[model samples]
Target: MPEASFSRGAHHPPTATASTAAASTAAAARGPDGPGAGLLGSLAPLLAEWLPRQRWFAGKGRPVTGFALVSATEILPSPPGGTTPGLLHLLIRAQQPEPPGHRHGFGCGHRRGAAASDCYQILLGVRTTLPPSLAPALIGRPSGGPLDGRTVYEALADPRLASILLERLRVPGRLDPLRFVREPSSAIPSILPPRLMTAEQSNSSVVYGDTFILKLFRRVSPGTNPDLELPLALARTGCTRVPAPAAWFEAAPPPEGPGPRPEPFTLGVLQPYLAGSTDGWQLALDALAVRADFTDAAHALGHATAEVHLAMADALPVSVLRRPQIEHLAAAMSERLDSAAAAVPALQPYRGALHAAYEDVAALGRTGRTWAAQRIHGDLHLGQALLTAERQWSLIDFEGEPSRPLAERRRPQPPVRDIAGMLRSFDYAAAVGGHDTPQDWAGGMRAAYCAGYAEASGTDPRDEPELLRAHETDKAVYEVLYEARHRPDWLPVPMTAIRRLAAAVR
Candidate 1:
């Protein structure tokens, strides 16, 4: 794919005048029903072929059997004088066959009997002839149906159409099942040209003149998105460590009965963009390059984390894990360890020691050691944190681990799970540039971080040694599997931690 290019202040209006002019006119004449029907079927084959190439597609390695159109609507009507271009919105359920010989094990219960269909949000720019600038976003020309011989591409990649969508979001309205909502206090410009952010992985983000960013969720699910939900909750409690949610959009399926519960799928979120801020991951790497002490920054990050946790505990529901829940948690960890060991040969040698770490959790539970659980930054790490030019830390991306199911990510978990993730991230930074830093650089930073956490939350993570250790071991095991699969060269980083952790237990 071509890299997204944008001029700082250019406003590309959504207009097309080519051979598509006739097609656009034809589409406009047919009214709304013209494009909605048969559009999905026409693009089914093309979507199946195109989706896998996208970075955000979760079922990358698997074959897509077919697409089931859950919802389709025309969000933007044809231009006043145009005949060739229109905007079509879709929520498609993609069907993929389960991998052969896939089985569920302990800790893996959350994912057992997983759904075969995954829903995706697609915004298409439909035209009869492709624009020269949008060739890169092409989804292929449909040979039949309402869009026959029409060039269709992902609309968000087009700044003109993206701006149009942003305008729609700036005002609260409903187009059938899709609802565009704006926070009452939000101040959004009616016309700010959008620039697509290419650095995004699982979702597409568009920045409007460095003032606000709209994150369009690709793979969507029922229930509230924690990315918007948690930050909104934190903002309510006067938390400054998170960006306030300005506006958001969602698609709510029609109610089935008088008391029916319709699952609302968050389609996009708009937040004030932090223009001059840098992510913690890059800041750590920069500090490592100069051999600068990152303890201060790490300390601040810990304090921010604790603040968010405390605010979440105040704003959302909290639970105390009893013996049964603790047992289930331990079993889940053991299952993950077994799966990792089977996948990564290097983990087999340390499997017994890892099992002991999980067993320790079970033993602690047997002694009636209760633990507090609440909604947290489910996938916290260095990358999830942002450090402003003023040296303050802000948390971003509360979507949690994208691979996990929606219900699992929303379930309450010990806050230490997040701390463990950050701890592992520190080790990763040290390993990435091990030669430039002192042997205990990462360790020192980790200690300072925990110290800061204890100071802010008034509860030391180190006080719960068994819970912390088991969570850390569980995180390391996950890293081993992830590294082995995605980054073989980085496998040693987590492997080293695994060896030390296992030996410590021994």
Candidate 2:
């Protein structure tokens, strides 16, 4: 997962809704060695303020210094004295001052220089005058720059422009650096009214009627994103537990970059939309509202997860985490705990206990134990699962944690990492649902989920107590840090898990 990646918080639908570092149109005409640039100009100041404010912007802790154009394409350039809005697709690299005492390599695709920079995907809607309906999506009127005297807002917020995105997917071709590709067997219906999806935290999604959903990666890097890669792999296995991508788009990497020529960056994916499907998070909450049993759903989800995991193992590369790899894994987890604790003081007291859990893994490795590793859903939670009209479980959003590097997300890992995330999600549902005995509900669901996994895979996750506990601890620590930074109100949810896990070690 690049810092800019997709997160499936909810599928609720219309909302509202580039690259080049600094090369000019003249430079492009001359065929300069650089990718492309110079689209933002005076708009840089406005973007400095506006970029960090977006939910998908990952550089939250630091102030934006400036922006450089990586690439720019005028989907519909603004015409002189015209009322019709213009759409500009841009990839801009946002520069931010490095935090004091921050070590390098925290996340992938970050440019380290005078300032740390992260590239973002932006769609700008340019209009001569603002419409009342589009006001909420306004980025701000640039006082000067290329977009002078014009109102610019999020392009995806406008249904007409969003439909343009779908049309691009419908007919696959190259838009210079960007390329749209579709499955040979798939045909996307033209002119499906596009509606913006709300509640996504990391990426933007647009639904084309009820037929397809397109997720646009907000923060971008140069590589094939697992959200597109993994589902395609599952599709090859004939797995219906995950929605296969119908059409997708990507950007070719800049040719001038150092090191190996990087793979093209996955920009967006289009997949079959499961209309009327309830996400597992909402379903669990609804069940708790009525004091209904969710263990049945949990069990079914676990089985579905097993099926996908098995398929992924068969379809993608698998490896064994020998003593050295296992030791390195535990060390990495411990390092994350240390870094997270420093930023979140609430985690300080639990550090000792959590470290002990990681040590348990290291100890097991010292005894020459090994664990099997395979390509599994890097990030799995209740929100990532859906219950269809048929009441069957289908997993979505294989992008993994957005803060990780693309390479790490694509790497094979123990399947329990995903199981732990789902278990934590069940606890979150119980807490958010305000169940009287939240622990009791969550506990039963956890047990039932594991039982179902055992039934399908012939192995219970609980059978490896130390390994399971370590992974769960890792997930909880990550949750605590995420909640602390993004949603303070949700802090206590992971804190509860931290307390229990710490106490258990005691």
Candidate 3:
């Protein structure tokens, strides 16, 4: 999914009084057999069956053994009149039954019997009758219990409810555990129609009349989300290459075992929407289709990337990767390479060379030459970039790779890692455009990008050849596994890179 893409719209009368009463009634029936049983106990079986079917669910191959409710709140009560459509915001913990010895590839960190669970954010629209427009988003009707015979569907798919959500965000207030906080300088209008962006894989978005876009994160983790954090930091550094954050919503997780404390988990973010902007992925494909020289665009994108990196370095904490940290990074890459080789048979042939690429980086670290590290766009690709109508590049999606742990994604890393990601994206475009056999166009674009980065940041990525090669190789290994699992037809794209890199190593 393009990082900046995807959202829903209407205004209901002031129904706070009616909503409060409805909320009270719903809360009162939260037992095993009451009208709210579906919200508590009965929703698990339904979610277990439904979640696996979602494209965003990461635990597709694993069986969901049980569900633990992290928190549940009635964000909106049944609208005025006799119509009963309540919007409920939920944070659910899905328990996965562990296989004896399974290790997921691409640094997913999935291990047997190790907290085998994932947290998901679900916005459910509950109603007695299914609307024809919303029938596609239907989760399923409960067989029995509090919500028996009632339909529950993804609420973000409903434009009316999505507009209501926008109004709620426009007014800064706390809804118990859920708090809507707006940027102090934001000037968003109160009534903009909303439209759902349907191309997203890991999140739901609502675009508000081309004014702002709200992204509701699907899988959530504790602490401030980097998607919000990084953009805010970049804005503070006076970086116009990223859209400024307008508003965000977060909820305090319910207390856990003894002495539970309140820690906020970011649920969604609102940012100024760039209407008519084209994503870099599509832009590259278009350029490739016509065999247009993409060197200028690639160079401009590199400058934008370097600008963001410089801004991040100025706004966030920076560190030097000493021997131990460098070794650890190399080790992690080696581990991912091993896991990818095990998962993709095509990668096995190149494992030795890939292992050597990681070793070369480790050997460089042993030479006592420390590299600068700072927060970066950890999972940068063409899809994460946007070219505005002004023909300028803008970066998005600082949440990093979804598979890695939040702490790991937030950790400082060499900027070349991002540079390597973009280079790989260029290769992907070339391959998909039928130019992989001669890769000269992609190679020229890559060199131009590095030149632009050096011109902007005063540090040529090519100066660190070993580190760059290793990072690129690591990213390709990850692609091999990802494509093998999710997109088997695209497996050859990364396999080409693997073969070329292996030949170079030999």
Candidate 4:
């Protein structure tokens, strides 16, 4: 994938708005549907045709399963183009996941020339109600979004959707295939599978074949997303470890354009298409199989990550470090987890373990630098992290996890969530890489990673080991809930982890 931060494209002509206004008003005055749904429906078919071309659309090449407008509101077109109004609408369907969702609502940018088209922008809802089985893995709130047609977020916070989003990427996030029998295709067939990929779940990423990633938004705060923010900062750091951002397209909401716009932005992101790089989980196992040099690689990755974070704080306004909060932040987390856990059956079995884990996390949450908050890879894991030929680790999918609400993903939790994520990755790496042979190798790799991070970040985890351990444990319980729903086969991975955490406490 090409880097999003560096755009080499030449300038093009600006958009037009005259036709957009004429079309919207004409349709409204034309009574929404003159002949079929009439002119409006005429436009729907046009949009249906264009949707598959979109980076966000799931089944582009295949036939559009269906197109129906849930709601529509008119908004003024971008300025310079004048008062041309366009429809801001929500489009839904039965997509691959059986529940079939939205192709998303679009505010088609001013339709020009002979088309007399009415469109200007798009605002997508980041949250979706899923089956109970898949709910536990979807944790966190959306970090930023375009909800009810608006940009969301104002700070350097974690994405609420992280938990669920990450879980959905696991291998078995699919629903019972037998439930939703295959349907007929209008054009060809739906190439979009029922299973959602991480890149697809977060950013609208697609390929000719093999992989597609979707980006989800919620919270609808106000600012460019970090997926758009951090890569630019990292580019300045000139780090080779991260994936070259391929291509990223934001909903690109018009600000103070010629009119009153409702929808916020469109989904856009394209990448070079990483074909053969080993997944971090696979690489971790591979590395462990060899020498004990995992520490050196870990140190380099630490500096790379630290460098990105530090640079982000300096460059982007939102990347500025979050303010200090109460030392008892863990108390708040425990409370949230306790409440959420009750609602999640998968987490219920380990309720007592959760409470104990919470106490430890609450204790640790008290000691870390309460003010050290900054934009983090909200859902860090062996899966979220990938490897590059430069022998560097790259991070992808910044939309956080989709299952979360937008608000929480935007909250500032301890940076330790990210730290714990890396540790977990190492654990997973050791588990899978060693042919399912349990080994203490993960510990050694984790120690090396910590040392590297501490060496450069000047962080002192030993001072807060208990606190870190507590956080790690709480996170582990959360993982049990995650894998259980998204990848039932992988449930044992986290179940064992929860047991380990509980035993440690005992």
Candidate 5:
């Protein structure tokens, strides 16, 4: 798959997420200009305009997207930060749709849904030096509020101007300047306040090999970034599937009584670059290109996925939610289903069928033992896995759902959630992507993966049928909603799964 451009490239959803980075040698060989000032100038406005429209933009991109530079400092003396500022932070603001119904058509011709209204920081991750005009844009500094109302970072234009700007900051010796957020704990640490974007989210600048990714975390409820926490915990447990962590950095304010106390917040993680790795989606696509080989590979992927989940259960600590009475589940389902039914008129026709499945799953939960769940790969999707040409599947990105609170994301849920996620991925691969003729492989692969999960976790398949089925059904429902909203073209993938589930139950 072709890579999306710059920091605007990667996207993970609320309660879910998505990284890689190469070096300068390869960067120079890149097709486009990459993300630069002129790039920023043109791209910035585009981002300001487009970000709000994206579902991933969190609560309507920007609510206000603009820029204000606080300070820019250069680490290297001679070479200025790439074509952008060495250390640049810009505060941004744009309009967002007023919540749900409060919105009225007020923008453009028709109302622009909810538009971002206020502006904040737009931190720059300029490679080497800070740009000149950019400094004037910093907002919320000790000085307070966004400086100049300039919408874009102008510093990227002059290399020398960017240099002097980078020299201004006083980084703490104890802190990693590159680290930016605590959600994805592991990240590439830039100089203190690397490049600040006064936007409404916390982001991580991670360089995983030749692929440089900036993961955006919208909701922040302090502590270690889950991105780092989950992977490291898994690594500590000696889990081999995930992409290994190379380096870590977090930003913290300089300590008291000392010179400059370091900021303790983690912003990003720098990982070992996986240059030409393909995600599971592409991997499956490739495998299906050769019908026979697809089964074996799918089976292996299923095995790997199951192993990862099992290892995950054993590795991270978990918490169990009090089992809700069957009625409670019915109520929740009723609400969700009602909304879904309204959204997709066809669902209203199957309301009875769907409710029956939810009740069964709820009963299973009621009778089963819920545990203090361990940390799970919250957003377990095929896109999260990396496949090398050698065919080794590398599980990556432990950051849980990007939408939920960090603590909630870290909280343990049914281990089945992850398994269901993978299963859904398999169907998604075959149904959505052009990976046909692997129907048998997909079925057999599911069995193998499930079996492997039981074997590794030592949890008997017979012991958790209810939980397993419930999870699968839940995932199927979720997938249906997801596809309906995001990939309407592929809505049938999950809908078929749900209908299949309904039939099986019937």
Candidate 6:
């Protein structure tokens, strides 16, 4: 598979002419009841080979068994002149075998873990011939079916088609199953140039004239995505700690599906871009490179996080995790540890010690202790936080961990989970920055961050050492498995944390 390209092609005449007979043929091939109706039948052969190689594809190491097209829309018709490519928006479900020992059920009224089927939002550019510039975005030519002999490539790679998406979001309306929603009174420019963000992310992002950034979720699930849901909630509370959604889009689930019908699936969200802002991950690394004290920045970030949490609590429902809930949380962590240890042998030696951490949580629950639970930035880390030039911290990407089931990602949880995730991130920065005494630097920053959080929220995470430790342990266990699978060279970074966490447990 070619590397995902961000190259842009010059704009051409958006209008073209084609014979009526030819147009009918193209429509028939792409139409649902057309002779070449089963689009996936032709595309599956190519997608099965190409999808797994993508950086955003979640089901790595699993073979794609098959694909089914949930919906397809011809955003643009193929021009007989062939000066520009036609755009096709597709929501295709890729089916794969369930991983061994996978047991998490989709609590959102869907069957899961029996078989792995993920719906992906794809934009394909169809043309009679491919351009040299778009060679990298090519998905390959279909040998049969309606798209037979036509070149299919990633559409977002083309600037002309990328602009069409923004045009859709500029107006609030529905195109059959796909809905384009614009926030009331939100004015979007008509001709902002779109350029694909070249970052390797779980989803694709396009920056429009440095004015707005639209995140297109690659792997989609039914129901409101927390990335949009949380920010919208915070926006209601007048919170400046998160960027509000300017516009967004989603797909209405089919009314009569084979299994459970789910809520609308959020496909993309557009938010005002914070120009001249840097992400916290790069900011930390830059600080580390110069041996600069990052305690001040970390403190500010913690304060920002507390503010967001407070706003979230104010805008959304909050609950208390009693003994049963606490016990369940501990059990879930233990199960993850077991799964991770089985996948990564390096975790085995520390298994007993790590298990002790979760047990402590259960013990506290057994003593009738309770903790506050609310919706939070599920996958909080340095990378997810953005720092403006004015030193203000704005949190982004509330979609949580992509690898987890959608139900799990959306579930309410203790804010300490976010705190723990940030704490682990400091360790990652220390390790990657090559600091002589990485732990000392990370430890001090962590203390400062907690101090700031305490000052803002009127509660110190350190006061509940057991709860904090357990979450941190769970995070490190997750990191170990992730690194082992994706980046073997980075395994030691998390392994060191695991060793420290395990030793602390003992």
What is the model-wide C-alpha lDDT for candidate 4? 0.44
The TM-scores of all predictions, comma-separated, are 0.90, 0.90, 0.90, 0.55, 0.64, 0.91
* Candidate 1: stretches off by over 4 Å: 1-35, 79-84, 100-115, 254-259, 436-439
lDDT score, candidate 5: 0.49
Candidate 6: residue pairs that collide: none
Per-residue lDDT of candidate 6, residues 1-506 (tens digit)? 10001010001110101111122222333454553353555677778788888889988888776555566777787864477789988876666676676775544222453445677889999999988998999998876666788899999988888999999999779886789999996889999999999894799999999999999999987789999999998998999999899999998865542556668989999999989999989999999999988999999999999999999999999999999999999999999999999899999999999999999999999999999999999999999999986779999999998877777888889999999999999999999998999999999989989998998999999999999999999999998888997899999998999899899988
Clashes of 6: 0
lDDT of 4 by residue, 1-506 (tens): 01111011111111212112122332333254431122223333334444444444433334433232222332112222233222122222211111122122122122222111112223321233323443433222222111222221111111222222222232212221101111121111224232334333323332423343334332122244555455555665665445434333333222333456433332333333455566666666667677445667766666655555555455544421222244355555566566546545655666676567656644444455334555666777777666665566677665554334333454544566677877777767666666334546777767777777677668755456655666676666667656754677777766666667666666
lDDT of 2: 0.83
Better candidate number, 3 or 4, judged by TM-score: 3
C-alpha displacement of 485 in model 1, angstroms? 1.4
Please, what is the whole-model Cα lDDT of each candidate in the order they appear? 0.80, 0.83, 0.79, 0.44, 0.49, 0.83
RMSD of each: 8.1, 6.2, 7.6, 16.8, 12.3, 7.4
TM-score of predicted model 3?
Answer: 0.90
Worst 10 residues of 6 by lDDT: 1-10
Model 6 misplaced stretches (Cα beyond 4 Å): 1-36, 104-114, 257-261
Higher-ranked by TM-score: 3 or 6: 6
Of 3 and 6, the candidate ahead on lDDT is: 6
lDDT, residue 123, candidate 3: 91
